[model samples]
Target: MIRTILLLAASAVAAIFSGCRSAESTASIPAVRPFDAERYLGTWYEIARLPHSFERDMTKVTAVYTARKDGGIDVLNAGWRNGEYRTARGRARFRGDSTVGELEVSFFGPFYGQYRIIALAPDYSSAIVTSSTCDYLWILARESTLPLETFRQYKEQAAKLGFNVAALEYPNGRPE
Candidate 1:
């Protein structure tokens, strides 16, 4: 009887831990395949994003990625807020396949967040990225501004993917 009870407790503990891990995983989101990480390296401007506490009232946001010696990617995200530029440096590494746009990024040590690219332009000019949850989404462009029509198209794509498009805010205030 004692052995059976111990086995049940162990199973329960394993189930609980697995659930917690999945909560922080982006397995539900399908990342873009055939992605070229080499071409994706460089600066990308933030066009639009769903509201988040860390990026509140920020404008002219941008992200820069570079190849790291350890085969990881170095990340630098910056935004203009309160009349000054605020920046956060992070690191990202591929979760599995390098050709797939699924990465785990960490700004805080040992606590990684999902960085999944759901859409991307063939020429690497624009992209739509999301996180483990539906709450995090971003539209990025090579230039600071994208054509108005292109922006709308990207918004529609996000909407189709079940993102809350209506809640997205333009960091530079809607492309002109």
Candidate 2:
């Protein structure tokens, strides 16, 4: 009887520990803030990003946005792969408050998903971007290269957002 009781107790303890870990992980995620859509509408070069499946092995990434005739923004994304240029086009619309930097970007047919600007510079020259669910993330720059100090600051911000900043892949053209 004692052995059975001890086993049950151990199981309970393990379960409790697992629950605590899960809660802690979830709580570590940073809160999303409102972003200004208009001020964010422009071309941005990808400076760094967490390793993602779609963008793996891609370099020289750039995203461009222009006002659309139907009150949406036309999105054009391009990158260099294997010495060739690859591109994709999409559309984005402000989610709720246009002043807040949040929008839904769609590339495959009509399906859309959240694109939130989590951090940005005062001149809008650089920004740290993420999706609503925190699955996608990217660091954007107005120029092709990012200064070391600025990159470090952005990495720190991304770490606070529950991202593994160590996983970021910086572009190869610039020296670290």
Candidate 3:
């Protein structure tokens, strides 16, 4: 009886570990060519994102990138949470190739991670962005709200990029 109980406990532990491994494996994001800094430098309102530690429970988020005098990029991120304004400043620099839409952004300090522009609209109205590890994603738009058709198209593109499109959370408190 003791041996049987131990074996069953071991089996349960293995199952739990296997489930965790599978979840981690599916969290990866797809790769895309580097992004064009010059064209991408502008204001982007966050339409949706995968729940992330840095941005959890946040709403009314917007990011603005500007060309810097030092040949780098300046990043200003702002959001409204709990009826107050929240902001963070950061910097970004191209890693492999800027034209390919891949760059690393740093907020606290030298720590940086990939910021890939996977899908972009021809009119520059919206884009689907992803992180290097595929752990984070953001749907950005020039306007506070995206048209239904445009939103659908972006969702399709994000699905093609291996993102969990259904996991996206639309901005709360957005005007209908």
| Model number with the top lDDT | 1
Q: Give me the displacement of residue 147 in model 1, in angstroms.
A: 1.6
lDDT of 3 by residue, 66-138 (tens): 9998768888888866787878777777766556666667665445655667777766788887654334567
lDDT of 3 at 143: 84
lDDT of 2 by residue, 1-176 (tens): 00111222343355467863221232234324545556777888888865655666788788888988787898888887789887877778877766767677777555565566777888788888765433456788888888889988888878777777766776545425
Residue pairs in collision within model 3: 29-134, 33-100, 34-100, 34-101, 34-102, 35-100, 35-101, 35-102
Ranking by TM-score: 1, 2, 3
Clashes of each: 0, 3, 8
How much lDDT does each candidate structure score? Answer: 0.78, 0.66, 0.65
Displacement of residue 110 (Cα, Å) in model 3 is: 1.7
| TM-score per model over all chains | 0.84, 0.77, 0.76
Instruction: Tell me how far candidate 1 lies from the true structure as C-alpha RMSD in angstroms.
Output: 9.9
Clashes of 2: 3
**Lowest summed lDDT window (length 10), candidate 3:** 1-10
lDDT of 1 at 29: 68
What would the per-residue lDDT of candidate 1 be over residues 42-129, giving only the tens digit for each residue? 9999899887666778888889999998889988888888899777777889989999998877766565666889989999999998
Predict model 1's lDDT versus the native. 0.78
